[model samples]
Target: MAPGQKLYPRATVRKVVKAHSGCNVSKNVDVMIFLDYMLFMQDLMKEATIEAKQGGERGVTARSINKVTKKTLSKFKG
Candidate 1:
């Protein structure tokens, strides 16, 4: 979370998530997507900390890390 940012609605997030549940993106895309997601979260966390240090409000954003985990599992499943 950040200043003036609202959390994504659970239902909306769920809908977005469900649509991507079976995405057939390639391995390279998968890796890049996951890596980009992780990096984005990491940066957010850092920003949150900095904001908190500055006495501004800080918050956490929910992200899907398991998608990549499932992708990895799928690779081994077959």
Candidate 2:
């Protein structure tokens, strides 16, 4: 991913949040949403890398991700 590139557009995120909560979200909320999920995904990938290394793999593979997913989700449960 490139710097400053976003997976989800802020306007779309705001719209989805509003649709779910029936309340408008501010710009800050949009930023926070992006930051929070970005951090979460970064953490998830880090864990997957570790899992792959422990399993003698060269990269993060699907098996590594699947193995660590439950443990990772348990950490970030909200």
Best-fitting candidate, scored by TM-score: 2
Q: Residues 5-72, candidate 1, lDDT per residue (tens digit)?
A: 98646555445545777654443454455576776666555554554555533433223333234444
State the lDDT of candidate 2 residue by residue for 6-43, as single tens digits: 67777787888889989878877788876888988998
List TM-score per model, in order. Answer: 0.38, 0.69
Error of 1 at 38 (Å): 0.7
Would you list the clashing residue pairs of candidate 1?
Answer: 1-59
- Estimate every model's Cα lDDT from 0 to 1: 0.50, 0.87
Query: After TM-score superposition, what is the CA distance of residue 8 in candidate 2 from its true location, in Å?
Result: 7.2
